[model samples]
Target chain A: MTQVALMNQVVEWVNEAADQIREKLKSPIMVEEKSNRHDLVTNVDKETEAFLVEKIRTNYPDDHILGEEGLGDNLSDTKGRIWVIDPIDGTLNFVKQQENFCIMIGIFEDNVPILGFIYDVVKDEFAYGGAKTGVFLNSQSVNQVENVCLRDGLIGVNGAMFCHNTFNVRDIAIEAVGVRMLGCAGLDFLNVIRGKQNGYISNLAPWDFAAGVALSEPLGLKCSKFDGSPYDILGERQYFLVATQKTYEEIANY
Target chain B: MTQVALMNQVVEWVNEAADQIREKLKSPIMVEEKSNRHDLVTNVDKETEAFLVEKIRTNYPDDHILGEEGLGDNLSDTKGRIWVIDPIDGTLNFVKQQENFCIMIGIFEDNVPILGFIYDVVKDEFAYGGAKTGVFLNSQSVNQVENVCLRDGLIGVNGAMFCHNTFNVRDIAIEAVGVRMLGCAGLDFLNVIRGKQNGYISNLAPWDFAAGVALSEPLGLKCSKFDGSPYDILGERQYFLVATQKTYEEIANY
Candidate 1:
């Protein structure tokens, strides 16, 4: 199969995995602490990651995987094709509210993203993309969203970004018409795709953003470090995806 | 009828009115600009408020009404039995997303809140209360929620609150595990009742908060000014409704 064909297959596989997870999510799952008591992981997270890894290994034996919850192979490099998975993004939201969580998967070829998918299980929506195929929501291709200005736009940031006096996020927030921190990076990425927000910034791991970056680039989003540098996949960094050219320029200057 | 009976009657009336609005919401209504281009008011909002006002007038001839979009009486005082209404809280969300908005109504008897109701029309759920009766969701009375610490709690605030540098909201948000701004005060209030959030703070109109205060008070929530004082009905003050007694103290100190 061509790389494009492989990306499509990956999308299908992730969709199936999402459906499986959603079915079991009807009942409460066991929750455990991760980095802190506030940082939660559930049985669903581990089970879903294991399920996805098993399927990928069966289908694409050569491709490596990196996933949260340590279900996937330990990766030395992003060489060749690698699948980065976050079985349950927004675990806190999932455990507490049973909504706003999503399944995320991103395919990268030689450290460059080739495909991204974020599925909102509760809403039954999926956002997917790669530069070659452009961005899509479900089966429909999305329009190239216009870049809006920061003063007239909605921006998303992490709660910590806005607080703690670091990065001066408060000043940045003041310039936008609105600021939203939905507690889910995948959901926030979807909002950017829908034009509900001009951009978002957060401290994201590779699994949290790999698929989002794949979807965003082709949709005309300017995804980069807070200082407007290229995204480094191996390094966990605070980055933003701006919707409009004007907003990107404004934020960069700010 | 006793005061409790009267409040029940009002609740029933509001529920029916909410149902009417929800049914019509199935069809796309014309959305127009209000205050500014970004601010929207839909035909559904006007129609719903009108429907509610007509019901209140027919049922309680002596009661005064205050409603968003000027569908009800022009009110200068909270004297007597006053019904404060926001036919659609989160009007922008209703116009765009069609999910996060809600119908909010608060009945104040002689400047004191006697009843409050917030109906999530799409979700077919409700949170309601009055001074004489405790808060309830659907048919069950909500238990007095335990207090949570800010570091372990979720909080909801208006998006603009974070951006505007008002009351140092950005700093406050960093102290919580996560923060959310879902665009509807009513929904935020419900989350607090569900224990999904420790508390919420917003600069809201009376209609936006009247019903919420009613529901939150009986749920052991500490609803007060940003400075931790009693909330004023007529003033558009920054208010906080903390989930736990401990959370309230922690935030107050922060």
Candidate 2:
């Protein structure tokens, strides 16, 4: 299938998933701890992931799937066409605030990032694109972000990482004009992609940042591990960082 | 005029002012520095303040106005009916991100906070209320926030303050589950008022936090200086802090 047609189909599936979440939110959501009390997963997360997996399997059976809720295939390697999904990127926010959460999907061909989609369900902003398609917010095309330095722009840091000075993120926050913590990686990626903030740093799983890296890398953003090394695509809980070109250089050197 | 009627009128005027801002954003905004390069003010800020002040003066001529743009009265005491206004809270966000900024206004009678309103223009969420009216988000009535302790809640702190550990805010950040910095005071206040987060701390002027204090205090949130002392309403740049009942006690004692 053509990339455009594939993207259109995926968008439809995502919209349907969002509808399910919104409907479920009207009732009480059953929440459970994933790793700890601070780490959460709701029933909506599993439901959304299941629905998306069903749609993908029915149409693109050849493609491998890796999803957050474990409803998809158990892929050992990042080979061939792989779809990475995080049904609810900010599960804690989804359960607590019922906002600031997102649905994210990344399409990779032969371990090379191609197309991606990050949808803010409550705000109704669907950011999608990749190298070939470029980037877009809904209907409007997004341009490459201006190269701003860390001293001149806002940076989003993981709340715990910033406080604990992990990976020297506290030093980066001190250098930036300001720091923001939205508690959602997808929304943070959207802000960086749209030039709202210069960069973001967080420890993330493959599904958590696959879509963001695909969307941002094409927009002149630099994506890597916290120490400025290239990150493994299918790695677990890598210290992820994405930033404007100059800001990236500044942080990496620091 | 009755409090409800007065609130309706103010809401109308605020809506009108928001309309003006939306129209003005279509063109290039004129930006200026207030205290430093980081402290910004825009043409929209001055224009919005002037508009609100005019409406208030025309409708209630006896009330004094104290506004961020200096388009209002110079009050030495909080003795009479007074309207405090921050034309555009988070001017940096307005100048750069074009989101997260808010219009805030507070009413006081004889040193007592009577009513307050905070309008998130881009999101179209208008939060308004006081001791007598109870808090509200648009048409829905908002209930008092649960008495969550610092360890179980997210806290919003001024970015610089958190980094600098101003007024022992670093200790508070260590106690909370997480920290967020939105760069907009009014939006932070709205989040705290709605129980989305448990607390926020910043150094602010009367205009910067008056409306938030008015709306939040009525919902059983505690408001005070960062040092756990009573704050002066007409004072300049007091270390302002707001949190849920239990969280307040926790932070105050810490």
Question: Each candidate's root-mean-square deviation in Å?
Answer: 3.6, 1.6
State the TM-score for model 1: 0.85
Per-model tally of clashing residue pairs: 5, 0
Candidate 2 CA-lDDT value: 0.88
DockQ of 1: 0.43
iRMS, model 2 (angstroms): 1.5
Fnat values, candidates in order: 0.46, 0.58
Per-residue CA lDDT of candidate 2, range B1-254, in tens? 78888888888999999999999989999998888777888989999998998898888898899999999888888888999999999888887788889999999999888999999999999998788877789979889888889988788898778777887888888778667789899988998998888999998999888899999998889999888878776788888889998998888777
Best by TM-score: 2
Residue pairs with backbone atoms closer than 3 Å in model 2 (clashes) = none
lDDT of each: 0.79, 0.88
Q: How would the docking of model 2 be graded? A: medium
Candidate 2's error at A157, in angstroms?
A: 1.1
On lDDT, the candidate that comes out on top is 2
lDDT of 1 by residue, A103-148 (tens): 9998899998888989998877898878887778888988876777
